[model samples]
Target: MEPPVNTIKLSQTAKDQLLKLRRHTKIDQWNILCRWGFCRSLAEASIPSPVPIPADSNVELTWKVFGGEMSDILILALKQRCHNDKLGTDKETLAHQFRLHLHRGIGYLAGDPNIKKIEDLIAIATKK
Candidate 1:
């Protein structure tokens, strides 16, 4: 079965931010960079405001390319987040929240000053 989020089209800003993140972290793969961004956004406690991410650029990826072997696990976690945030458990809501979190996470990684290297990401994870 195909993942609920079959394709991801990032905003122009998000694409630019992801490029910067790639340059800094030395992670060239878009899927890997996006995984970091998505998880980073989810790690935050606040609900992301619903904003439209215009697919202004050519950046797009299949869900398998994005989630890879962890697609099922990521789907489950996204569904749980939807339930927790009262965003409804329907497929549409889950997809919307997934996009929101992915964009926000990319922003988090792009905006963070402390994440100069891969080790900083690990440090942030271990910090209490």
Candidate 2:
């Protein structure tokens, strides 16, 4: 069935979580990719293996452990995988991974104790 038109509506709690996620994503992107040390480590670690790699492995684990940008490393891995015609996987894997990251990030933000009363404040902050 088609989705509802009013689906754009979100509870204040959800809105706050999203705002936090966006900020977190942006920070991670900059601090990890823009930093010389982190960027070099990530690029060095992103090289494909001599043998075939699995489709769903934590592509950024090595780089992440080395202070590389986790998000950037993951994106590069996914893009490489997506471009390989020999791989049997489809775009569904990419979509699912994106959704999983979003869910985890939002949950993390919601569970932060420092964000008390964030549920109500989120909507106000997110309205643009």
Candidate 3:
């Protein structure tokens, strides 16, 4: 399958929220945090809320930067998720969902009440 596009951009509000998550998580790299966000959203039992975030920020990441060593795996996961959601698996649809899931995951990480520190992320991960 074709890898996801590198045109993924975040909204200003998303950048701000991510910055907040950075401060809380103490993880400096945006791409790393973004990977966490992507997985978090994908792991959710339901579809993300339909709120369309504006692509206003200058921050940009290639597929390599976003997924690092797991780029291909991430693409596969996204494709599988698209199929599960009954969405088209075309490049365009994948690109759109890449944006949606990333933002929704960012929102999830930043919005969670229990994640006050880096250790909190581990707590959530191990939670039953």
State each model's CA lDDT, in order. 0.86, 0.36, 0.87
TM-score, candidate number 3: 0.92
lDDT of 3 at 40: 89
lDDT for 71 in candidate 2 is 47
Q: TM-score winner among the candidates?
A: 1
User: Which scores greater on TM-score, model 2 or model 3?
Assistant: 3
Candidate with more favorable, higher lDDT: 1 or 2: 1
Better of 2 and 3 by lDDT: 3
Off by over 4 Å in 3: none
Candidate 1 per-residue lDDT over residues 1-128, each given as its tens digit:
44667889989999999889878888889999898888887788889989887878789999999999888888887877787887796778888899999999999889999988888877877889
